[model samples]
Target chain A: MNLVLRAACVYMALLFVFRVAGKRSLVTVTTFDFLLLLIISECTQQALLGQDYSVTGAIILVGTLVSLELGLSWLKCRSTRFERWLDGTPLVIIEDGRILRERLAWLSVDEEDILEAAHVQHGLLRLDQIRYAIVERNGAIAIIPWREGG
Target chain B: MVEIKRAGDLETSEDLAFERTSRRVRRVARSLLYVFVLLAALGLFGDGPLSHARAGHESGFFVRYERFARVDGTTRFQIHPHPGSSAAPRRLFVSTSLFERGHVEQFVPEPASVEIAADRSIITFPRVESGGFVVLVMRPLRPGALRFSLGEEGGPTLDLALFVYP
Candidate 1:
């Protein structure tokens, strides 16, 4: 088996597992999520590269991983619930021109990081200008500006 | 009644547009699937030996020495010969920016002479003895690839590979 194909297989398996585990599994990657990722990678490494430890084994493993990722993406497009579950629904971190400090801390993010992301995305220089801020599932922060009329 | 009829017609057109968009997306998805399958098939069944051979060929003539201890303000080259080659002394000429401040030294049974030119960047070693399997430490000033030539000018060339360890 090619390394990529093996890697693809492992990746697809992981994606399927995550999808089955529900939206929360991917929504907030806690310490548990990190551990799962590490373990999966370790297992996949052995399966892809094999115990032989040769360059050929390594290539086949990588191929498997790529194939798996492609397959999962295809599946994700066909299912909205699966997409939401794996990718997570974006969480509103700031509302009504007020910072949701609790949610930020919960996501293991700092004020500086959110501020920088907001500034880069929306030219939001101050927290007061932001009507709503969302912590996206893909580990990104988005800020919506306060409307002038309302 | 005419307004109602117009609304129905607009609804039908919107539905048609959605259907067309969906069809285009599905077509793109199918094409992508075919490409992925083709790549997988190629990786599995096509020219496996050829790929390995190519990797091996590329690995030749390139020596990589990584993460060796760096002495204060000195760059070093650690040359290790490929497996199963005869151990013999070969002349070497190194041309690189690495020797900007320092000089090259070879550690063998015999004492070797190192001559740095007036430019201070270029160093010439006439003959450096290699005692079978041993590491030669050369301290060059700069940190980069140092090209080494292994024989006298217009003389029969010998097989010697150069590697830098920083």
Candidate 2:
């Protein structure tokens, strides 16, 4: 029971923290972020186990975490807005050779990021050649080029 | 400065769709954040500040310790350990800040094995087998919710609200 309680509390805390930190902080997976993630895992260990290292306690903790995650998944499926809130919605960074500066700034992203994605993904040399650049919900950039006829 | 075109002239059908969706997401995210903050506040209120923020609630046999104390004031409380099949003496750990610099009454039983942490607030009982009521009277030095756990720190804690009187 203590284990379950600990697991639930830890899960809630971690979830809120991750949410506030934003997906960009995680998706890139920089070396510093990796270290930070490791340290967070280490810190949560004591909070979850507490003074009890019994096998029963370990089982309860693991079970509770898994159950909570599964429950969130179920909640997400049932609620579209919840899914969007948790994962964020995709945004148009560029439309018809014009950059959405406000949108990019809101995400802490710059023109260089979109250009890099454009160059790498679409092999487009010039920014004007691209009709649209989008910041996906998963923090990846997607570039769309203007069609030959249009 | 990065060149940014006005949304009114530059936005296409696709851009409008993305903007609408993003606005919905922003609203949802704000609401979610507010909800989470409220939940966190409620949890902090329900659990003691020094309870180590465990993910679970206390289950199993527990002892009811003093739930309130005052700074520089006398408090008398009884700990009644719920009986179980095992009659073994249960160890009690009082990580309570109330014990810091406070004086335990003379009548309180001497714990078989005890340790007062360096900060002087945390008290540990290595072995306490008494299944009956153990009454404790103390004159607390500090005020605030004092955390007393059953086994050890991060264990099941009973927070005693303390209000200091000037």
Worst 10 residues of 1 chain B by lDDT: B1-10
Two-chain DockQ for each candidate model: 0.03, 0.02
**lDDT (tens digit, per residue) of candidate 2 on B1-166:** 1123454344322334445666565557768878866754553323233322321233443444334444444655555443443345445555535455466773255555565665333333334453554556777654454544333344454544444321
Candidate 1, residue A131: how far the Cα is off, in Å: 1.6
User: Model 2 residue B94 lDDT?
Assistant: 58
User: What docking grade does candidate 1 earn?
Assistant: incorrect
The 10-residue segment with the lowest total lDDT in model 2 chain A? A16-25
Over B1-166, each residue of candidate 1 has an lDDT whose tens digit, in order, gives: 0011122112111122332343454456557666755754453222222112110112222122222222222333333222222433333333333344235564432324444444222223323333222334555433333444332223332232223222
Q: Which CAPRI tier for candidate 2?
A: incorrect
Considering every candidate listed, which one attains the maximal lDDT?
A: 2
Q: Which DockQ value does candidate 2 get? A: 0.02
